[model samples]
Target: MTSNTAMIPSFTPSMNPSTKGTDHGVEDGVTGEKLLFFNYHEYSVKNYRLIGENTEDFHEQALIITHFPNFHVPRDSNTFEGTRIVRISRYFKGVGVFVPQFSPYLPGTEPAAIFGDDDTNAKFIVQGEYMGQFFGTSSYSPLSEYLTEKEFREIVEEINVQLRDAYNSWSLINLLLFVLDLLSFWIMSDLIHSLSKRKLDALFNFIDTRNKSLEKRGIKIISPRDSGFLSVCIVSTVKT
Candidate 1:
């Protein structure tokens, strides 16, 4: 009979995406001063605090993953220790709500140009380049010290697979929506144009009548006091 227990692996590979000519795992032309985006999924939280409330430590723990800096680790909030595995759960929840609609709008089939090599774990808008001194450290930080390199890589691989699937699915859905919208606009254009002329004429008439009423009431249209009398005049016009 075969043993039911499984053996633990000793080593894993790096999950970082390969860049051209550089082993640093970051895209070309990415300077240090750029703004890094991170996605934080919080598990437990306390009461909501309005403005001027003492609410510094609302969440007990959170799982944060670097998003914008892409494969590069950011100096600020670099550590991910003591956080539970909740990425899979979040992914499922997002899929149920059809999160693919938010994928970047681009023409043609080549999403890789925009998404780069690893599209899954690091999809974000590259918000301009950093022109000044770097505010954050450029050194890479391990997700956890406890896990071996292989283990870490494997986990990240799983995450990337999940993310890629969601994004690809979303892109397809978005394409369908775009086609539908185009067809809809084409079908309704003439009907909309015909109705708009009558609507515009009615609007001009309403504005003229309202202006006359305001003039009769001796209410300067821009005055603060005119707001109260404007409502009264509107009601009288409707009654008439």
Candidate 2:
């Protein structure tokens, strides 16, 4: 299974009420709330594995296997969204996953992208779920700020070994298929980089053109001091 990991008790938007409004989204008759798990919860999910079909729609039927410490739950749970489903793995004893509801929020400017609304909370939950995949169980900690550079490299090496072993187990045909996948990824990355550069160039050029237009209109476009001096001269001349 393709897996990844993230740091838990992850950084969250400040708890100030002013920032709370930015955390929610509403679209398509649905509302989304950010769910952040504190480390001291009575029970926290340790391992979470999500298995789904390679379909464009994620709402299709899927299985989520997880391990919850100090909690006992049934093996199979109810389905969700009338289509998406979940069940606990017999191998892992934990509560069945409950899919969080999310709908994109449009801020009156740019419409939110599909599934972008719940991305933050999704990250927070997934981090607590998959810490073992990236960092070894013994070495992983929510207090990553205490880890030294050498310790961080050791964790990375451990993850790399796991990835290498998985790659080495593939058959020759699968290896070739993997190569094609890498090429496609590279091509897409290059295409995105090129588009980003073009957009940045266009934005800079527009700023430069606007500055020139202001200069032609006798508006100093550089330091605020220059503009202030010109304003003072105008004021003095009017008083004289």
Candidate 3:
């Protein structure tokens, strides 16, 4: 669905250093260099009322589409090289087709003019000019050259379904792991308690046998307070 309204892209002179009047190889009217520019288009999408609810959904969908078979691996990890399909899926997601009420416009247009800076305008203008050149001006649509709106929607929905399935699978795995961890902890605690009890029982048995032997020899060990005396008597008896 091509719009009848022609999008006239414009870029600031600062964006194109060639447009600046040079004085002895140095650009004239040059100010301090800007490292980063605020992107109005990104801000608009992030704060859009219609897309707010689906923003997280779209991000999850993008994640699944980009990393389909490799969900187990972290995205920042260098192990997985992006394939052609992955790159295509990422591009499709970035196109904002699934984002509700998203209207793609060339630079210096309504949203861009309202929210974008020089850098944002320059960026979009370059992209639009390139696309216009690649695809003929008469048949250029902002959506896609190959896929229709319906086809694109179908693909997005299919990817979303896959994403949901993956989330469910991961949730189940996490639950199983948690249960296993609890079970293991319980078993270890029980084993340690059992071992401690056995050792304590053996120590008490040894003390009882010693007490009985002392009693048979007319040396009656009465209370825990007499442990020092018992030690002395035992040492004396051992020496004898």
Ranking by TM-score: 3, 1, 2
What lDDT is obtained when candidate 1 is compared to the true structure? Answer: 0.25
What digit string (tens of lDDT, one per residue) describes model 2 on residues 123-180? Answer: 2122222322221111112212222345433432332233233334254744665566
**Residue 121, model 1: Cα distance from true site in angstroms:** 28
Candidate 2: 10-residue stretch with minimal lDDT: 231-240
Q: List the residue pairs that clash in candidate 3.
A: none
User: What TM-score, to 2 decimals, does candidate 2 have?
Assistant: 0.16
User: Which candidate achieves the best TM-score against the true structure?
Assistant: 3
Of 1 and 2, the candidate ahead on lDDT is: 1
In the predicted model 2, the residue pairs found to clash are none
Evaluation by TM-score, superior candidate among 1 and 3: 3
lDDT of each: 0.25, 0.24, 0.26
The reply for model 2, stretches above 4 Å from the true place, is: 1-182, 185-193, 220-240
Model 1: which residue pairs collide? 12-150, 100-170
Candidate 3 structure quality by residue, lDDT tens digits, 1-240: 121221112224222222212221211223422111111221111211122233222121110011012222355654222211111112112223332111222212221122222322232111111201211111112223223445434543443343333334245654565466588975654434333234335444544665676444422222211332111111111100
